[model samples]
Target: MKFLKSGLEALDEVTVIALGSNMAGGYPSSEALLEAALARFPGARLPVLARSGWWRSAAWPDPGEPEYRNGVALVETSLRPRAVLEALFSIERGFGRTRGAANAPRTLDLDLIACGREVIDAPGLVLPHPRAHERLFVMGPLAEIAPGWVHPTLGRSAAELVVTATVGADAIPI
Candidate 1:
């Protein structure tokens, strides 16, 4: 961790993380699994500052599967973007999330939506998640928690993006 002249970590970044789940696995319900996953953020060094209530939406590409429970989290942390991504992946794994088919039902899905104002496009990481701004499941909850959060690249607030989100339009707070 790099300390600034004022004693703040260079990585004192308040970030947005999007959470989603459709399969409960062993938990009683997907919503319960989501709550459990949020509880782990603090242990991962990403303490949750605020979070939106869980929203529900039919599974995309195949509504025949299961409905998804999604929400957004605002966390205060000292971890850089890459480390934040790693922590999210680790949390997902600890919840029995398996990497298999695309769009498959998942026990937990944690996405690093934005890391402050930094813009990064790496092989396995992308700041402000590439398509997050286009998904209502991601944006609606975000607008609920942080309406003024601006997309690093697009320069649009979460409230603005929610109106035009093309995907996940069926999402509604549950």
Candidate 2:
């Protein structure tokens, strides 16, 4: 058995998937995003953490709406980063995520290229979340699962970033 050897060598990188769902209505949330991902990727080993409290962040130029309920997940998969990203986007679209806003409250969002063992700043993706070190909501939940996973560029771990980033000071654990 022979393998195709191109300029790009066989990349053996682990996948770190992040899942986030949006809240619908004012009371009974109509969005069901995370549950759907779980159904699709069963036996996923990453810890699924969530935060229910919505924070009033700068809206992403969409229709001004309610704050967003966000969370993060750390998954381990063999699929390449791009492949995983596509899968996540498909999941987001399934939950009604439109590219209408830069920071709008969404029904569901699955940011697949959050972090990895190495730093990757590509055209469409930036590893370690690029802003992971700045967002508490992401750091908090990511810390729960990948405390030891270090940031390729920052020389820090998820736990460190979460504590350093105070944005999630009022995150409601769910």
Candidate 3:
């Protein structure tokens, strides 16, 4: 495993990973689950280069549900886009995530927000996650770590998009 060069926005190795957990499952808290989850990425070959602090945000489509703990990680990986996605899903399952009703609370939710500057749209994988820019939970932490990151399709930096994000408007750093 080699480093992806120094500094935040350099190197083509950069990729964005969104982390969310509303249910701790066996962990003590959602925050704890998220922290432990980040630690697992390196073993998956996606070493975390930079990470934002955990954020608290109301659950979407239903605010009455337990709030979600969210954050973003910038990692450097040589894996292709699809492989990167597969690794993320595998990591989620290891933390007890299950596929059920859409948006159901879960022990862990790992999303591949972007793969370098790759703009991909295909079955089972979507780069720069279709709705990620519209969600504060994603954009907020992204802004904290890589404020200048421009979406492949949206054409705006995280710092710029976070202002107008339509979902999770109540999101705030914990």
lDDT of 2 by residue, 88-142 (tens): 7776666567877566566776776453465677888777566657766566655
Residue-level lDDT of model 3, residues 125-171, one tens digit each, is 98879999999999999888778778888788889999999899999
- Best prediction by TM-score: 3
Q: Residue by residue across 127-165, what tens digits does model 1's lDDT show? A: 879999999999999888677777888988889999999
- The TM-score, computed over Cα atoms with residue i paired to residue i, of candidate 2 is 0.69
TM-score of 1: 0.92
Q: What is the lDDT of residue 116 in candidate 2?
A: 48
- The parts of candidate 2 lying over 4 Å away from their true place are 1-14, 25-32, 42-64, 113-115
Q: Which parts of model 1 are misplaced by more than 4 Å?
A: 1-13
In every candidate, how many clashes are there? 0, 1, 0
Give stretches of model 3 more than 4 Å off: 1-13
Judged by whole-model lDDT over C-alpha atoms, candidate 3 comes out at 0.88
Pairs with steric clashes in candidate 3: none
List TM-score per model, in order.
0.92, 0.69, 0.93
Candidate 1 residue-wise lDDT at 127: 84
Candidate 3 residue 95 C-alpha distance from true site, Å: 0.9
